[model samples]
Target: MTTTTTWALARVLRDRDASLYLAGVVVSGFGTSALWLASGVWVKDLTGSDGLAALCMLAMWAPTLAGPFLGTLTDRTRRKPLLIGTNLLLAALLLTLFTVDSPDRLWLLFAVLFVYGAAGVVHDAAESALVAGAVPAPLLGDFNGLRMTATEGMKLLAPLAGAGLYAAYGGASVALLDAVTFVVATGLYACLRVRESRPEPRAGGRRKQTAEGARFLWAHPGLRPLVLAGGTTMLFAGLSGAMVYAVIDGLGRAPAYAGVLYAVQGAGSVVIGLASGPALRRLGERRFAAYGIALTAAAAGLRAIPSDPVALVCSAAIGAGLPCVLIAALTAVQRETPDALLGRTAATANSLVFTPNVVGLAAGAALVELLDVRLVSAVIGLAWLVTAVPLFQNPASASRTATRSPSDANPA
Candidate 1:
């Protein structure tokens, strides 16, 4: 790495609050990734049913559907204290997993997992808002990029560790591992030095409070394109992802070969995430996300050619490109929204961007049954290209238009 690049990344780590926040994220991410994989395995082992195992993931993800609602809690309180309290609560809740010794007790496990997921949504919203308040605005892009790197990096290794620990000590051990991380994260959260003010209660009823987040996101011209492109990209990505086995079959490779493709894709994401800070500055969010989508689209189309080497390259490109819209959209959300509405706005934006991924997955599974993999790949690529076209404004112009002062924010 160049000295300049190294110093840029090190700056987040060297700062007091950023480093503590990043450390908390890294610690908890390892535990979260590990437990998610282990939960599925635990159920699979007890019930000997693939469907039951799959439901474990569904249990965790289902709570995100209520994300905008959950986000309002953060806006109504001081985020740092809320962050600390949620961590402690989850730490205690994870301990309840010890009771899941038999198939019959799976309900308890699912209940805890559901709560765990809800907590995650709240934690994420609070963290996003807190980071915006704590980190220097100039460094927000770098901070967010490094956050993705920490998360993606944990995904690469934590599952292996979870699987090993599960094999050695069983499900309860995995739960304990997660619980301990939360406690450590709680401590880290306590050490953060950001000052927070209690937000005044909104005049509306509870339901209206939640709707405000969605309204703000839709009305903002600058954020609308990035978030829409993000959602669209994820949808295409999901469709393309569902065809992984077919892509392998076409190449005459075993299904196990898919791991190699995923690993390369993940590495590509890691590399892109490391450079994303500077890339966002140079290309600006609009062109950055547009080009990333274009790269992803091109790679998806190329995967239909069925060469192993080409598949690897395409996988890396896909992984690298997918995060661009996500990062851009999130950074823009932090920069544009007023603090009073930030938590809900961030949550609403996430729901819009990521929920389509689930829809695309379901649709792609059905499409794969009816269409050729090559045809499916082409359709997704074309759709991605369509999404990118509108987002391809001049970076210089986009930067000027989008870098709005906070005082310009619309009142809720």
Candidate 2:
């Protein structure tokens, strides 16, 4: 690591609030990843239907559609206690899943999973709003990158553990494991030491207030481009994500080979996350995101080459490149939005960014059937390339961000 990024990461690690936040990410992320995989497995075991098994992910992700409304709740509430309470509430909800011993109780599982997704939306919005105040502004990049690393690392380890526990015990054991993690995360969140000052909610009905967040995002020239690019990138990513099996098929490899590709991709994410702070400091936000998207564009086009090594490289490149816009968009949202509107803005940005990913996945699934894999990849790559071009333009707002002192650009 560069001396600058090393120190930046060290600062993030040393700050009490940042450390607590990272710990919460690790603990909660692990449980969520574990439960995500195990729930699908549990469903597959019970119903013996691949379609039903796939619905577990859809169940968890569906509530993101309601993210703006959920986020408004965060804006009006004191975030720390609300965060703690949500974790505790989710824990209690997971405990109730102990009664889910048969396929007949599957409705209960789906319901809990749906609520779990909603909690995630609120928790994320609250965290973005809280962290802006808690962590120093310059270190936000380092903090966010580290958060991404911790999350991706959990994805690597948690699923195997969840699967093992599920095999040895049952689905209930996985729920218990997730519940315990939430309890631990609640304690971690309680331990964060930061002065949170939320501005009073503007006087308006809920609908108008919610609309305000969306309006601010669309109206901010700097934020609007980044958010739109983020959404566009995710849309292409979803299309490519659904092509994994097709990629494997092209390589004449079994479906299991995709797991190896994913692992490499996750490792790439972990590594790039460590460097993102320095990159963002040096490149400025828009350039950093633009470059990452460019790298992803190259990776997408190359994935059609049909070589195993090439595929692995493409996977890692995509992993490393994809987080740029997401972290950039999210960190920008937290930095630029006023604290009063922050929760709603962050959630709305997320909805804008990720909802397209779901759409892309659905679309890619259909597109892959009708077109050749190479052509699809080439088109997707071209699409990402188009998405990236606008971000490189010099905007008035970006000039302001670029002029901060080195200390402000880096970390404290």
Candidate 3:
């Protein structure tokens, strides 16, 4: 809001370690988003079925349903090594696209997409866990804001970029650009100088680490509702996202228009991500979390109304609400959970939260064949809205403290 606040936010990005990681995230994000857009368009062009086009959406995200396993593994390994190795693997996979036609070997596309999703899970979990080690806990909100902004900004641009590249140079050329971006990101991760001060495992921690993380989430009187609401938001968001290609394809619009829509969605995310910190500071995490769910439901409801212009408006609103909910929930975890358990706790929550997305994407695609896409959107929208009612009903929403850092919440 104030110049001082803006200056403070800028300083979070200026930090040497944070800056390098942010740059890598931005480039890698560009690559990921480009691939998603290109692959979705490619699948539709080749298959000539809206259902199949929507299946491509499932291919891109369903593997992430196994995210908890990957998240736990990420916590066990060194961060830089994982990032570098996965980046290289993803790069190679992108390169392989030139040699094989995905249309003929649809299963191959699934395999590649699954690997990409799995790798993405590990990458995100490690990268986020590593941040607490780089920046002070007090500034976690600002740091999270910067990461969200970079990610969403990439989502906004990559679609347009990928579409143009596909039209002129083709999918192979786009894949080549993605491979180069990964290579650069890998190099940047290697060059980041700050060594992670890994948290000491708790006594008998090895056996109980995963269990404790699960128990922590289950026992948290406050977090259960937030997780449920997050899961609901993910479902609707995934459902709505799957329908984007169908909407455009049905109109006989170029895939580039899908990119434009994504860009607009990204613009909305950027605005919300930047403001998330200030909102958390003012609203406290709990009520803000409730508000995020409410906003998401409202956005999804708007989505069911069925007009191109209205769809864009709804998409942007939901896109904006997602970052707010994510930041609130993640910041709450960071504020309430212990340092020793941060990685596992994060893994557990992220996996559960994303599970509905897997279900939602598949269901969204399948539902469209049986019913009107707009009606399906309405059903999913109403479902998300009903699911979030707990956020408002829970008395804890009013009394929860938001400013306490993870260390403050857990003294050891």
Estimated TM-score for each candidate: 0.94, 0.95, 0.81
Candidate 1 residue lDDT tens string, 242-353: 8999999999989989878888988888888888888888888888899899999999988888788889999999989999989999999999888998999998888888
* lDDT tens digits, residue span 58-160, model 2: 9988988888888998889889988999999999999988998789999999999999999999999999989998999999999999999999999999999
Model 1, stretches more than 4 Å misplaced?
394-412
Pairs clashing in candidate 3?
Answer: none
lDDT ranking, high to low: 2, 1, 3
Best by lDDT: 2
283-328, model 3: which lDDT tens digit per residue? Answer: 7666676777677677766665546787688768777877776777
lDDT of 2: 0.90
Residue clash pairs of candidate 2? none
Better of 1 and 3 by lDDT: 1
